[model samples]
Target: MGLIHLPTELILLILPPLSESDLAHLLRVHWSLYDIILPYLYRRHLQGSRDSTGNGRNEAKGFFRCIVTSNTAGVQRFLDFGADVNAVISAAEIRKANFRSTGFIPWHDTQTPLNIAASMGDDTLVSLLLNHGASVTGSRNHQDARRAVQPAAVDALLSNHESTLRLLLRRASPLSAPNMERGGLLNCAIARGNLPLLRMLVNEFGADLNATWQEGVYPLNRAVVSSGPEAAEIVRFMLDKGADAALANGGSSNSNGDEESTGGGSQRLLDQAIRHGTIDTLRLILGRGVVDPAIQPLDTGNNIFRTWIIERCTPETVHLLHEHGYFRALDSSQDDTLMIAVRARRGDILQLFINSGVVVDLNARLTRGGSTLLHAAVVRCKPVREAQAASSIRCTTMPSPVASSDVPTVRKIEPEYSREVLSRRCMSEKVEKCAPEEIVRCLVRGGADVNTKDARGISPLDLAEKGPEVVYRILVDSRCE
Candidate 1:
């Protein structure tokens, strides 16, 4: 090996990228990888593979890898030449561990060789390192030619330590602080959705059940995003570990985590699950009862419930929330959601709310003075007919109309309220605009006076000027007396 200067080593590093040789050659620069990398790559390639598929082919292919492992002969010879299997950059560790948090890892964001090996399905190389006494406990073992183990690296070691992984539980600190990734190896295992691995992390490695990760996310949050109830149990583990009923789901402090943009990753994951219409995941998470609903990202103003609505959470789920007292907060003196739904012309969802005990005024609008859901639809500029169509909810189609066996006790709501609901909807909804006649008929049905106008004198019929005059004529023809 004619390799001589630090500059030559740097040049050697650059040469791999420049040369036709596979990139693994540069990684082999680490004396420790001499025997380890090669056998590991080979073992992985043949880990679960079939017969006659011997060393030659995989060895040749691995030679062209980004992190090259050599032939067994070369590896054994290099090891025979006396390479240290464990090279600790002690200074790097001490500075990193002391200056930062106690749980800092020198290579926190990057994966360890074992992690990469595991990720690539390399079981042999994995076992090889374990056999050779490679430091299996931290991110890396550079001792500045010294020794120390931060909690983060210890977690890494345990994460990859097949036998030691689950047995290290007694070593875990109960400070509620996790190393490296907040929730530490436990979240990683949970994120990977490995029940056995998570069990090992919990029962043996001593991972904090309530430890938060990346953001203020917990293992339960990660598990719930998935479809299975198995993930939900991670939260239960925390609960068993003396975690408080409320750890997270929404709302977070930067001191405990990093500052996320308004509607950041946490919000997005929850939103995506709804957006994709996975009610199973939603129900599983909501059923767990630990998530906080009040943590609205102040900037986006998109509360979790609204996100669900925007993502079109099923009517069944909405009813479940209503039953469980979620929508009670929104059912204030002026039901804003009714106005919002009206503006969007989501008469189906609106009626669902009404059926679920949401107070529906023919003119329920936000503070902006919207009138009937019809006016709201009109104001939002949706089509007059399709938008104004009521009794459109499908959930209770058989009994949807709620006719008191045909009619109610004959209480008549004013058409002006219809106009206000429509107007409030205009202020809140974002669907297409409406034609004059459709708006007029919707108001008329809801009991609006066609000729009635606000202080400015612009009535539903007056606003029909934006469309054809026939619409106005039709409104006049059907005008309420």
Candidate 2:
């Protein structure tokens, strides 16, 4: 029987229950049914419907599936059937819909079909969507629409879909389409580490290379903090485009319409770059020849060196900054760098400062406790078995001591090293061991005044009494007096 011969009421009843695939097959039964069922099929596919098994159709999922599978025909058909190309659900509505719990929603709230297509790197669908006037920036009323689309484009770029990202950018309205954080599109590119996207945004689209967004974070700072292979290239590009490397992060103006102080932000940029371990970025910033090496935070009262040392910077990073002449800018009298290193247990960093050709006053007392680095180190050093073993191994490997004119002074000694110590020492002689001796040696070699006392007049040697024997012996051998 011809499908057209069926009663309209009966056809409507029969069509509403059929799945999209089943309806597509029915199209072969009668070409005349195309006009009647085609719209219904498109609607079912786009809007999604529930079946006897409680399975339901989700408009967002249906759209995303079409894009991911490269189902261009399906996507086009939906758009042809009056699917709002820029349709979006607000984040609140999506949460209310409970789509997340049911696994019905595939895309984020405020994300349109174009956003989904772009994120999947489907250039074909993306082009199709744009050609159909799909808004690059989804619903204006939805505050997060721009935020949603920007990251989607960034995700496309991150997926190496340069063409799709370009297409999105060409349609992107810089005024409205921004990252979720309200960071500009350029910042998005920077955060994603997409050099191609970043270049295109700047060179082609005239994106502000140094535009500050989201709490006044600069694109340069974002790029520096990101772990991208082309980070250096991106930074150089921004610099060549007149990006201000010295412009501090969070460089927003005050309510008085005056340029807010740039001190803290610039200092923070250096600190963040160091913390992120982006040596190339650091070098690039330093190469700019504009950043103040002595930039310190006004609010926190921290200099770059103090921040770096207190943050326990890695040996390589410490060496990098030291080589860059950062140590000279530090106010050594305020808080000794060596004291900061000792407090953080960063022996390697301490050595870097010592070997950097900078005059380190090892006897300099910490501003807070008036304690020397040696005093801090000894007080913090715990008794580990490795130290005892290391001491015994050193004694065994050394030649027997020769008689000297300098007689050892008899001092009241604790009996903590009794028979247990003797037994462990005997066992340790057979094995090579490692301990914090390297730390002790570094301090002593730096001319750390072991006899220098804290505010309470407690000397490093006195502090060492509570520490391991290996540390005590090392201090004693160095001749504290």
lDDT of each: 0.43, 0.61
Off by over 4 Å in 1: 1-77, 86-117, 120-124, 139-183, 213-217, 221-243, 249-278, 291-317, 329-332, 344-348, 355-357, 364-370, 382-462, 465-481
Instruction: Count steric clashes of candidate 2.
Output: 1
Candidate of highest TM-score: 2
Tell me how many clashing residue pairs each candidate has. Answer: 44, 1
- What digit string (tens of lDDT, one per residue) describes model 2 on residues 1-481? 7668997667878987777688888877776777778777777765553335533223455554565566899788878876666665444444554434533333344556766577567788888988888766544454324334434554455455678767776676442244442455566566656677777777777877656675456777776665455666787888788876556554556779655545454565665666552567767676665355555422124655464444444455566566666666333454456655665566666676777656447777765678776776776677777556777778455687986753222111111234433321101222221235567778888787778887888898898888888889889989844
Q: After superposition, how far is residue 29 of candidate 2 from its true place, in Å?
A: 2.9
Q: Where is model 2 more than 4 Å wrong at Cα? A: 1-25, 33-36, 43-64, 89-107, 142-155, 175-182, 249-266, 294-308, 329-334, 364-371, 382-437, 448-467
Residue 481 of model 2, lDDT score: 45
Q: Estimate each model's TM-score.
A: 0.49, 0.69
lDDT of 1 by residue, 1-481 (tens): 4433344445434432333234257446776544444444444433322226432211221211211231334433333333333322232322333422322233333333333233333345444444555444443244232233333333333334444442223333222333333335655555544566666656655666655656656555565544333434554555566643334445444676753344432443344344432354455445664432444221134544564372244455555546545565333353456555555445445556655544544443334443444444444443445444633643563556644562222112111234333322101234333443444445455544555454454555666555445555656666634
